[model samples]
Target: MSIQSILDIGKSGITAQRLALEVTSENITNVNTPGYSRQTTIFQTSFVTEERGFPLGTGVNVAEIQRAYDDFLQTQLKTEASTTGWSSTVLASMKRAEQLFNEFTADGLGKSMQEFFAAWQDLTANPQGQPERQAVLARAQQVVDQFHRINGYLTDIKREANQSLEGITSDVNESLTRIASLNDQIKLIEIRGARANELRDQRDLLVRQLSEKVGITYLEQTDGTLNVSLSLGPPLVLGNKAAELSLEPDAANNGYYKIFATSPGDNTAVDISSIVGGPNNSQGRMGGTLQVRDSLVNGFLSDLDELASSLATEVNSLHSAGFGLNSSTGLDFFTAPTVTSGYSGIGGIQLAISKTADIAAASVDPVTGGTGNNLNSRAIASVYDKVLATSGGNMTMEAFYNALVGKVGVAVQDAQRSSDLSEGIIKQLDTLRESQSGVSLDEELANLIKYQKAYEGAAKLVNVGTEMLDTILGLIR
Candidate 1:
């Protein structure tokens, strides 16, 4: 080869090696960086003409630095990761709820109910005893207090869930805005025939993050922009624009929250609460929070009210049929009162008995018109047994409360199981992606050695060319 040609080859080789070295260095530097894709320098030979045909030189040029990635695999990983994230969040919240309602705990409602019933049984054994009457009243008060405490805890949990939803919504909106801005930037870059791969990575990362707060689906538009939506059909981010979501008090209940979406064109409000409440396997933290608020808490409170009502009614029926010793007339030992659904106030029916009933002269069978029987102890004991034997003697109010607590424990266990499974899946997917896209220090080191050798060979070529040229000049001299 001619000296000039050789020089040209050496120069191209040097350039290629330098570029390869730089790429290897970049990979090594980003080895610990999260979500950083390793880069590789693409090389191509320069074409040359021979005597009879085209010839190729040993020189090389860097075509481009390619980022290692598998688009389809990344998409799958992101989707799975999002689902795992949401399930984990909801599981944590549910676990907290379970702990709050633990029936096995010392201060739980189950224990309180049991203690109340046991106290009633003691009082029933000696209905005319002043000490036993006071004990019954005290136990009854404790039962009411326990209900109040449990209801209060449920209210607190609901309130906290609502607050968490609000925070998540704010974060989602921020991410949407960021993604929209990224869309605009990526579109502008793509319009110039440049691939905004880094920007795209950033946008994808944001989408994954937003998905954890509320399940989302996205589509890539023809313009290389993204359109995002919640599990519901409403748009969240469209191309270079984003929609705003706001929380408002539910029409039926001022304390409850309803979700609304804003249109980008004119900022018109659209109610999305029903849509959000629809059946969806893609429900995120927000949906779980709503379920806890509306269904779990509400159901427990309803059950409590039912138990209270039943107790009052049954006791009142027996009490009203028995005659008081102080008077010839019969009086109710317990009064039934009206209860409102979803109401948390403590102003309901109070269990009270006639304090003036002469225990020695009270009649158990007023229907038989008997008097001076002093059967008050037997009458009270019968009422207590009936209360304990309601629902086919299988479930007392105390047992019912215990069952409710057990249900909460089971729910928490189920949530934990789901969360663990989802987390494992996410980890597996992440490991696969990292193996494909993540930088490796050992690979970078090997590339560095190869590039160093190529650089030295190119330098040696240039040196030999210079020496040969100098020798020829000396011969001419």
Candidate 2:
């Protein structure tokens, strides 16, 4: 080989080795960075010349940097991330609702119901006692207040869950715009015969984050761009452009925010609340939050209204028929509920009678025609045991309320199990992804050492080439 050729080979070798060292250094620098994929330098022969029917090669060329990526694994991770987000969201809201119904609390519905019935029992035993009458009035108000308080708190929880819809959609929109921008950058880089390894990693991380906020279906195009869509329908991103999601107040949902998707070529937006918020849909965090708001918490409120309404109706029926000690008749002991359905079904319930003389504790004596007996008071207290049609037609008001509380507790437990299982699945997928794509400090250090040695060797070749060229020049002179 000519001395000039030796210099050319040494120069290319040094350049290739230097590029390889930089790639290794990048891996080591990003070893702790989240969602970072390890990169390796690719080498190729610069050229080949035929000499005496044999191929003579020049030194190495630095080819494209190869990024470690597995599309199928990443898809699995995104799916699990979506599931984990849904489960955790539902679990947290259910726990808060369960806390409100705790039976040990002094103001809990169960405690109030017990005190209410006990007060009636005392009034039944001493129908003329003013203190027993006053106790019954106090306990009745407590029961009514308990129902109102529980309904209010559950409504608040549902409202909070509804509020999350805005936050989640905002996050989803931000990620979509960022991903489209990266797609633009990635396409530009790849068109120039270079790999955008780091950019691809950032885009993948955004895609995963998007999945956690809302479920999506993604497809990678031949031109290195991602096409993303909602789980149900509506394109979110196409090529380098991203669609947007906006929240508008929905009249049908009592002023709750509804999600709307608008594409680039379309000015009209589509409402996707039912598609995303259906109880059977398992899309992502928004789905879970909607389930809690519209189904779980609202369902508890419905049950609460049922218990309060049934109790008030049954007691009023008995009390209005019996005559009071002062001959007061046809008066409801508790005000009647104005509505038959919804969370406010019990809102109008209160003590209809306030005076101790106003309580209808006496039943007209069968023969004496005197209103001095305790039969009506006993009957009002027994309404707690009467199986009302409002309460599934087989259980008393008390049993029905207790069963409702139990159902809430069970829901919390079930949600916790789902959350735990989803998180565990996500953790396992994360470990697998790290094993395949994550940077390892020990492995990076070893690679760094290897590249450093190669660089030293290339430096030596350059030195040798310089010395040989100097010797040939001296000989010619």
Candidate 3:
């Protein structure tokens, strides 16, 4: 080979080593940057030529920069992020619901119920006493007030969930648009035979954020664009276009929302609310919110309504058959429904009688209609021990209340357990991903040393080539 070719080879080697060192430096600098993948410079030997009967070797050239990544691991992370996000959100909302019940506090419905029944028991001791009757009325009002408080709080929680759903939908739409824009940029760069590594990493980070809101699945196109979809429904992003998400008031429940996705191309809208829960639920933060509003809170309200109806019906029945101080018969102790359908549950229950003289405490009256027998009051007091209408009549009022509170506790515990498990899985997956794609300072330092040696060796080779050329020129002279 000619000395000039040897010099050219050394120059190529020096350039390649310099680029490798630069790439190593970049990796080291970005080691702590979130979503930054470690990069490695690829080297390729230049084309070889023949010198007489020997094959001559050319120096190295920087081919391409590669990022350490695993597609399978990335997909697993997205799935885990979605799950963990759902469980954490559900656990938080359930805790709020549990707080509304407040079973451990004195102001809770359970205590009010016990107080109401205890007042009735106190009335049985002195059925003729006006003070005892007044106390019973006061306790009854407290129970009704508690029911109203619980129902109102549940309504507020449902409203908050609906409002939050709107916000989440907006966030998801913004993310879809950004991801679509990134897709366009990435495709443009890749079409020119260049890697858009940084753009890809940014897009991936956005995808993980999106997964927290809703479960997602994605496929890479040949032209370096992604086709992203909600796990159970229509595509969210196609190439450079994104579908829009919206929320509308639920027809059956005014305080909740029905989610929809609209295709940007054809302007087609599809209701996706049912996908929030059921066998095909996506199981993300949005899904958890819907479940809390539609299932958990609503269930508690229904249970409260049942308890109120049963209590009102039982008291009215026992009081209706007795006589009051004025010998007034068939006077309901509490308000009775005008219709034969009984009390209209929690919201409709009211004090039927205004005067304490209207409280019926006697089963029978003397000839003068002045008897103050305490039999009816004793019977009303026994309502607490009797199995009131609760869960097909197997539980008393207090037992049913305790069961309701217990159910909430169980749900919260279950959600927390799921959230914990999901968090552990996410940590494991993240650690694995870091091991594959995260930069290592020690590895980068080693690469720096190797490239530095190569640079020095190439410089030495160039010097040798220069010396050999000088000798040749001297001989020629």
TM-score of each: 0.84, 0.95, 0.92
Compared with the true structure, model 1 gives a TM-score of 0.84
Q: On a 0 to 100 scale, what is the lDDT of residue 449 in model 3?
A: 98
Candidate 3 lands at a TM-score of 0.92
In model 1, what lDDT does residue 310 have?
A: 62
- Model 2 scores worst on lDDT over the 10 consecutive residues at 340-349
The lDDT of each candidate is 0.69, 0.83, 0.83
The global Cα lDDT (0 to 1) of model 3 is: 0.83
Question: RMSD, each candidate, Å?
Answer: 4.0, 2.0, 2.7
Candidate number achieving the greatest TM-score relative to the actual structure:
2
Clashes of 1: 0
The candidate, 1 or 3, that scores higher on TM-score is 3
Clashing residue pairs for model 3 = none
Report how far off residue 208 is in candidate 1 (Å). Answer: 1.8
Deviating ranges (above 4 Å) for candidate 3: 102-107, 279-282, 333-346, 365-370, 389-393, 470-477
